[model samples]
Target: MNDSEKISILSKLISFKSVNGHEKAIAEYLQELLNKYGIESEIVPVSDDRADLVAEIGSGTPVLAVSGHMDVVDVELANWKTDPFTMTEIDGKLYGRGSTDMKSGLAALVIALIELKQSNTPINGTIRLLATAGEEVGQAGAELLQKKGYMENVDTLLIGEPSGYRAVYANKGELDITIKSKGKAAHSSMPALGNNAVQHLINVLNKIQASIKGYMDIKNDVLGGTVFNIDVINGGTQPNAIPGSAEAVLNIRTIPEFDNKKIIDLIQSEIDQYNNSTNGNISMEIGMEIIAIIGNVNSKIIDLIKTIAQPYMSKIKYTPEQIKVAEKQSELTGMPFSTTEIKTMGVSGGTDASKFLIDQPNNANYVVFGPGENNAHQDNEYVTKEMYFDFIEIYKKIFVEFFK
Candidate 1:
């Protein structure tokens, strides 16, 4: 397919107001796109409004599966200069809500796969595309696909998240826990009669703060640790009545050394201790868990991906704005001029790859590479034309090489 064809496909995808909870329409769009080329696909239902697209080409060994999320983050109309759903190319960047965070990646994959089918290449193995839903929320689509054994036979997995065309071999995992407290409610005038759930929750928070070091002390070489956020806390409603129920949520990004299971164990242990000591009516439940993905540095696929992305890296010039904090930190420095370094590193965010690892599905080496920008979930998200077009070529080249 030509560049214009690729852009048109992407525009159609972006036109759907997928937002977060709505992905079924886009999944239907892709199913029709595949049907045009006589390519067979199945729509894996995730919810009433969400579904995953799984399309495959060719037959036999060393399966290479390309995976990506279909759902994009919700957009703020006031923050965008243009319609967030309209795919517009200005200067060379394609601006849209999912343009970078990854409609482009999935579009590229679709184009490459369809083109390969039309080329009539002698098939030796399978090439699959798993376009998932709910990756931004909790990876529900991927979880269902894995449970149904979609990833069981795959030999390699490529996560097409926005990586500025970098070959990301590792990324941090995520664990979301909801802690609830229960107590008696009473009118504010009779303060001594009611046991405040808010107070109970506060006591539990203090225990976590005082004892659990979390990821503060732990660190990873590529994907550094130190993400422990008490993101949500809710307790009393009316000022006149003491709260009988309260809940708080915790988000932790885990590395290989410190994983989701271990983190949950630590939190459970803390809750147990708190309960035993003070009769703290606190109970905790897991909201979500995404395992950290790490691939061997010496893997042949990593080297191949790095080699393929070298020429494109020079054309990409995106760097996230650094936030200057009060703490003493390393000084900012610029990159070397005329350098030939390939963008091969780790990311600190979590992807749907984590959910695929729950059952230990084959030894599929998962790597994330896409035409994404760092300004994801922000206003005016976009993907450079160069990154999007080059990734199509990259995907094509990798498939040919891997099959050969």
Candidate 2:
């Protein structure tokens, strides 16, 4: 496909507000395009009118699943230079809300399938194109697809996330914890007679923060260490009348080496200790929720990807130390810049790949690859037009070379 056609497809996709679970329009659009190419597809619908589109070009075991999310993060039009939904070109940059963060990846996969068809490449395995919905909202589409047994026979799964042409084999798992504290309420004038839940919550938060520091000591070669943040907190009623209830939300990214349950128990213990230390008649409850994505590289897949990428090794930009050490290395490296290699490490961010892994477990060998700025879910999101086209060529080659 030409750059113009690619740009057009991306523009049309961005025009639709397929935000999280609202992917109906885009799913329909993709269905029509895939139909035109004579590819058969099926829709795995999630609640709220959102659905994931799966198009299979071939059949049999060792299926290759090329996937991308059909959702974009919420956008504020006023904050954008142009309409966030309208695809605009200035210099060499394509401006749109999901342009880089991954509508472009969908375009690449679509174009790759179109090209593969035109090439009449013979494959021994199935080539599945999965356009998942709700990746921005907890990866619900992938989660559902897995539950429905979509990945049952798949051998390799490639997730089109914006990783700038790098292969991401490992990412950190997430745990979201909510801590609530309750206290008796009374008139502000009689402070001695009343208890403050907000104050109790502050003490609990301090203890949690310290506990996070201790958790960081647990590390792994691939995953590094866990990272923690107090992303949300809600508590109290009005400013007056001693607040009766307070709560804080903690977001923790865990490495592969750490047992997720152990971390949860540690956080709970810290809160319990804080409650016991306080003489006030305050009660506390801690709720821990985990949203983990598996982070391990399949050695066979890593070797295959490296072999495919060897011809373009000169094009890869590596740090000085990495270049010297990896120059003669046959195994795929785990550093951040080695996008073509399957990673055995984990990171702090979660993706649809996590959902797929959770559902399938041992069903498929999966990795994430794409083009765009790493600043996903951030303001002023943008992806380079060059990167968009480059990924198309790379993906096309990988499919043809590996499957044929």
Candidate 3:
């Protein structure tokens, strides 16, 4: 397929506002797109409006899967220079909501699958396109797909996360904890008639803070051990009344060292101590937990990525142990691709791989390698035309070279 044709698919994908709860429509579109190319897909319902898509070509184990979320984050309309859903080309950048975040990467992967099938080359292993839903808000889709045995026998998986031409092998995990404090409500004028949930929550927060204070002192080798933030809080209704219940949502970035389970255990200990010491009615529940593990440095997936990517390197700084595979390039001659916008962009809290690789073999390899910038949740997200086109070629080559 040509550049314009590929971009057209991306444009169509962006047109669907497949936000956290609205993934079913986009899933259907992708299924139809694959069907047009004689590739049939199954859309597994994730919710009333969300679904996960699985399409396969070729056969057998040692499967190679191109996976990504079909959903994008919500857009802040006022901040965009242009429409966030409409594909707009200013200079060389294709501006849209999911353009850089992942839709472009998904588009490229889908196109690669299409072209690979068209090529009729003997693929020794199965090539699957596993598109997930609700990756932005929750991991229900990934967990469901995993339970359905979709990740079984997959030897190599490529995630369509925003990493430009470079391959990002490791990332921190995300664990969301919601601490709830319940108490009796009474009028503020009454001195000791009521127990304040807000006050109880304050005590809980203090204990939580003290318990995990030194977590980052001894960090993991890749992406640190833990970095946490309180993202949401809900409590109290009126100033004149003592609150009956309060809850705080804490989002933690975790590594293999200070993982989700350990963190949960520590917090649960604190909750237990508080409950026993002050007869506090505080309780903790996990909102969501995404697992984290350092990618296998010497895996065959990374090795082949390094192999095909070596010739594309103009000025390189990657090795076997390193994660960032290669720098961006222009054709074979090469030119500096501007990464000033991406340098300021934040990383994903976690990818679908965090859940998809749940019970898979330890030798199963995966890489976050795809086109576009890292401006995932930022306004006016975009991907350059060159990066999009180049990755389509790169993915096509990777698919062919893998079984050879």
Per-residue lDDT for 301-326 in model 1, tens only?
Answer: 67778777787766654343322320
Candidate achieving higher lDDT, 2 or 3 = 3
| Residue 235 miss distance in model 1 (angstroms) | 2.5
The residue ranges of model 3 lying beyond 4 angstroms of the native Cα positions read 310-348, 360-363
Off by over 4 Å in 2: 236-241, 275-346, 359-364
Candidate 2 lDDT over residue span 316-389, tens digit each:
56678765665444233234445354334444567777777765433246677777765566556777777787
lDDT pick, better of 1 and 2 = 1
- Candidate 3 clash pair list: none
Which candidate comes out best when scored by lDDT? Answer: 1
lDDT of 1 at 312: 71
Q: Global CA lDDT of candidate 2, please?
A: 0.73
Residue 73 Cα positional deviation in candidate 3, in Å, after optimal superposition: 1.7
Best by TM-score: 1
Off by over 4 Å in 1: 187-189, 238-241, 317-339, 359-364
- Per candidate, the number of residue pairs that clash is 1, 4, 0
TM-score of 3: 0.87
lDDT of each: 0.80, 0.73, 0.79
lDDT of 3 by residue, 8-113 (tens): 9999999888877788998899999999989999999998998999999889867888898888889999999999989999998999999987998889889989
